[model samples]
Target: MFSKACEYAIRSLIYVTEKSKNGERVSVTDISTAVESPFAFTGKTLQKLVKQDIISSAKGPNGGFYITEEQAKANRLADVVSLIDGNAVFQGCGLGLKICKENQPCPLHQNFKEIRKQLKKMLQSTTVAELAESQATQKTFLNNINRN
Candidate 1:
């Protein structure tokens, strides 16, 4: 249900967080490849994240993207979704209606409303560090080919 940019942002964040645990910075190219996203798209998404302070970056030979401990701990998946996609996820009509609401429900409104509520809850409850730790422990794989 996420846009390609949002998908890449989530993947990049998880990957970067895993790397950042070791005090390492990851490049755009690395993030793109790891997340299976195009380099340019990944770069743009990273820039947005950087601008939003959802992630941080540096410049120079050793410069790249890395998330601070505070950032990882404080930020949630919901924050990334909102930054990249706004409230569209929670506000949009399920069947593409311009104005679907409880009083004037669409065909799939009730089901979709429940789904959106669950999604929002999941996003709010999930932290970047939690996902990063799952990846770092090899419980989850970022790409088709397992790196760990």
Candidate 2:
């Protein structure tokens, strides 16, 4: 239902958010080891997140990636999602039919249309700071998806 890269990106962002209050600037190696992801690939995605200003970063010793309080407030879940996954998640019809629309509804269209709209709205509304606080306090587990 979701891309692994997108999932990793968000999870990593949340991890950054959780550590931000402590001013933890973690290295790529540390982040991947902590997040249980591939170092090189996740590093590239983190680079994009930094370039996009969805997260903050630095280079060299005692410098790496760390979210700021401002960055936590600035970034929305949809922004991270769009950065990693493009516009497809918000654009596609939920029904299997390619032509499912208001004029031509599929069986699953009605069921999906409302939820998809709600999901998009929720994603648009929430931020990493909000999500991180909740996720950190709870017994959260990372989920894996089949990659293409």
Whose TM-score is greatest here? Answer: 1
* Residue-level lDDT tens digits of model 2 in 4-58: 8988898888878887778789888877876788999789989999999988888
Q: What is the TM-score of candidate 2?
A: 0.86
**lDDT agreement of model 2 with the native:** 0.81
Q: Give candidate 2's error at residue 133 in angstroms.
A: 1.1
Model 1 has an lDDT value of 0.93
Q: Stretches of candidate 2 above 4 Å error?
A: 95-98, 139-148
- Provide C-alpha RMSD values for all models, in order: 1.3, 4.7
Model 1 regions lying over 4 Å from their true place: none
**Candidate maximizing lDDT:** 1
